[model samples]
Target: PSSGNKAERFGTASVAVLVRHKPGRAYISPDHPIAQEGAGVVLTCSAKPPGWPVPQYRWFREIETGDIKSSVL
Candidate 1:
């Protein structure tokens, strides 16, 4: 009340937030690389994540045939 000795009020509130994530894709630099005999080559690989918890990567060498390719040690 305007003229009352004291006045008080009650209040309540709520809030929310949402987070989403998606899988990652990987790519390699120098898409197609080749090295000469008695020479060495260096390649870099990376991945992009749409959300938190960054992505990790592993590398494997692939050998190619006339019409097919396979990963080898």
Candidate 2:
């Protein structure tokens, strides 16, 4: 209407989006009952709703003192 033209409509445009998320859970392959020392084990972890910034994973082991000790797996 400001460019020497008539107005066309009385409405505007709208846009929207929605995303759904599921429960996240970690999974371990070859879930063996017992693993020996110096044994090669494959540890796998993942999560749901991995959006925007990616998720980081950290592995830990429980020691005799009942304390969690971080480790690389």
Instruction: Give a tens-digit lDDT track for model 2, residues 1-73.
Output: 3788776768788887655555366455556646679996676666554543455777778989998777754
lDDT string for model 1 (1-73, tens) is 4776777999999987655565478677789998898998887766665345555555555446454344532
- Model 1 lDDT vs. the true structure? 0.65
Cα misplacement distance, residue 58 of candidate 2 (Å): 0.9
Model 2 sits at a Cα RMSD from the real structure of 5.1
| CA lDDT of each prediction against the hidden true structure | 0.65, 0.64
Indicate the residue-level lDDT of 3 in model 2. Answer: 83
Per-prediction TM-score to the true structure, in the order listed: 0.40, 0.46
So what's the TM-score on candidate 1?
0.40
